[model samples]
Target: MREVMGECLPDVVRARQKKAFGGVQGEWLRKYHKRAVYGLLRSASFKKREYWNHLALMRKADAFFAGEGENSFFLWQCINLELWFRKFID
Candidate 1:
């Protein structure tokens, strides 16, 4: 736990931010890149998922499309979706 780690090793909590450690892949993807990735996330088929919030997801992908993000991990989701469709739905 972060709280426990911080209590045991205070230095780590204050340590300068380091890359390659870890974070949400989706957040990273939305922040870093857009164009090629948007083909799937914004695809009409992807939006057909009844459980997902389509507009909100589109806004995030649109940010990348418009070149707002600095880096990204969202592409993986797109890739995974495509592969899953090919395997199970296609």
Candidate 2:
């Protein structure tokens, strides 16, 4: 789509800077990492069978809140997996 736009647009338009889209959730999560810490810590699935290092999750959460975490997408995946297990698994 960007290529098509560049081709169709004038050289002047094409020369302008391009911005990356979609980081609203990442921004929000970073800003509100403290609020999410409790939920991450309360992971039942994460506690079972050592599938994931529970302490590592806490460290990641801490890193996120401290603005040192660069793996927002991975954190989100971990959260989703925990939620999914709670919702679907007996």
Candidate 3:
């Protein structure tokens, strides 16, 4: 994801870059801006999924702990493991 973001950085910057001559931006510039915004929104959505998944896991862990013994330590460890896997997979 970082690599994708790094490659996208130039496209984002170029989309924002203004023309020096005639002070007028081209149609392609507007299109680039649209693409950049869409890319950013897509990235944000992907990140939000991670947050939501973690929240769901924490909720489940809480419920499990309430019924079972106080195994928060193990739950946290499992959460960490899952996060590690998600980071690589994502």
Candidate 4:
């Protein structure tokens, strides 16, 4: 797909990569990392933080897992935030 786009649309700066990568990542997270995602989001450290309401965040997480919307990016951000806290603050 990228190769075809790159060949046919030389001027189009390969923008499809972002969308493709995001799709792959979102699917990957749902299929392979669901447990890890839930574990991180539901961790004591994560919930104790004041940055977000625990219930609200859990609701969002559940919705994301339920395919409520295109919330993969949001969940990805939450995962990164949790990891960051673990690395630097926790």
Best by lDDT: 4
lDDT of every predicted structure (CA atoms): 0.62, 0.71, 0.46, 0.81
State the displacement of the C-alpha of residue 80, model 4, in Å, after optimal TM-score superposition. 0.6
Q: Kindly provide the TM-score of model 2 when superposed on the true structure, using C-alpha atoms.
A: 0.62
* Per-residue lDDT of model 2, residues 3-62, tens digit only: 879778888878778978765657767666647645656656566725688887788877
1-90 per-residue lDDT for model 4 (tens digits): 766777767655765445433456688888899999888877899888888787887898788789887788777887898889889997
Q: Give the Cα-based TM-score of candidate 1 against the true structure.
A: 0.44
Per-prediction TM-score, please?
Answer: 0.44, 0.62, 0.27, 0.71
RMSD of each: 6.8, 3.6, 19.7, 5.6
Off by over 4 Å in 2: 1-22
List the candidate numbers ranked by TM-score, top first: 4, 2, 1, 3
TM-score of 3: 0.27
lDDT of candidate 3 over 17-86, digit per residue (tens): 4656432232322333435423432443333654445455445544543454344444445445545655
Compared with the true structure, model 4 gives a TM-score of: 0.71
**In terms of TM-score, which candidate is stronger, 2 or 3?**
2
